[model samples]
Target: MKAIFSWLNKPYYFNPKPLYKLKISIYHGLFIFLFLYIFRPFYLHEFDEIILPYTIGIGITAFVATFLILYLPALIFKDYFSEDNWTIGRNLLLMFVGVTFIGVALWYFGEIYKEPYNLRKINLLQFLSYTFLVSLIPLTFFVFLNEKNIRLRREKKVKEIRELKKVQELNNTEKLTKEVSITSENGKEKISFCIDNLVYVTSQGNYASFFIKKDDKINEKILRVTLAKIIAKLEKYPTIIRCHKSYIVNTNYITDISGNARGYLLKSKVIEIDIPVSRSFSKQSLLRLIS
Candidate 1:
């Protein structure tokens, strides 16, 4: 029952789920109507004396029963379905059984209302068996739809994952100018940093900070991507200057560069950070910082 509801409620982005439910409900109602109408002659043969009234009552019951039969299991299993595959199968099974039960019930209702209503006279087992067989048509249809839904969901997920990977790859590619390798004393991890998107790299006691540009804004992420390894990575880019032992600056965004024996300054409207240029790299760093 839970599975049946889940299959029915599978998400469809463009078409709201309620609209789909309404569409399916109407179709089921019509299907039940046709099934009853087609078998009206057989019902009449057994209850000829009160056929008119019996037919009217059965029609009304069938109409209401069709939607109830479809909705009941949906309400019951509203939360039980968790897995996608099971949800699809359960929904189909519930609908199949619901329709079969309603059809058989309508048959019994017609017979019971007639003039010589002999409760013991009818073959209840045979009626149930026949109804079960008849329900296979709609059951098959529901199964087909369920399979299709699963395939579409899988495809959609695959597409979304592929797009996310591309975005991550592009971000990595843009930082290509900085080629820094990272190694941990724990020896569990080692990797390289691509410098294209790098805004700045900062050092902590035993860790490093990697600030990269994402959506035109800088976000600081800690990487085992060490400061020394990061310097090794940026070796190819001469413009990259070590401003401080603790800080490295991408000179591309440097607006003003000034320093004496104390430290160096780099300024932009959004940021102002001092770059400490060591005696060894001070000349080169100062030249890049100014240029």
Candidate 2:
């Protein structure tokens, strides 16, 4: 019973496309029509007739009514039944109750109309049982097929996103491999390092402090250059992003990001100190870190 409920409660089981719903309804109508036409389940004793046509008609009408009934709520409360917000158990149970009630009501009225003033021939228990049984088959099939399609689409989208990320990461890694030269404004003093080893640069009044990783330790080198000049020179490197007025960091070293009332702070795995991320640069810093 639990397994059955789980299967029925899968995503997209209740909410399917209108075309798919129409196709399922048509399939259901055909199944019921054929079943009753061949078996002749209900009998009218007074008329001494097998109510085959009426049974088939009632089955198709009940399912069509059920489909329309389900559609109204979905249309009115779109967000409630949206993919992210959907509650499988609640939605499926409501749908089951609704379809069953509609099916039973159709069967009841169908019997009364076929045999007016002849209540004895109309067995409510038998009518309900048959209605529920017929309803169950088509509903189960529709849910299974809808859930399978949804799962396949979700998996395909996830795979595509992962592949795209892999390609971007590869390109970023290739860019990081190149060496960059930083020179002082006077053009007399210059320093060069592989983009990967450069951790960060901090402004220190008239000079800029460059922190580069060598032999697993951070080596600080002070050059006679302004932060503005360094920023202009390193603007071509995508991974090296400026996070604050006094600080520019290589995103490859960022381990964590935390925010407070003041603003955001970025932590680097290679550096012992935490870098302040200004409100102006916070959004761009995060985007570069992730990208």
Q: lDDT (CA) for every model shown?
A: 0.56, 0.67
lDDT of 2 by residue, 179-285 (tens): 87888879898999888899999988788999999999999998999888888888888778887888988887876664432345577778788786655552433
Give per-model TM-scores: 0.40, 0.45
**Candidates in order: C-alpha RMSD to true structure:** 20.6, 15.9
Model 1: how far residue 15 lies from native, Å: 11
Candidate 1 backbone overlaps, count: 12
Relative to the true structure, candidate 1 reaches a TM of 0.40
Model 1 misplaced regions, further than 4 Å: 1-23, 38-56, 81-86, 116-121, 149-291
List model 1 lDDT by residue over 101-176, tens digit each.
7767766774566426763344777666666666666576756665676556545543454454345422213334
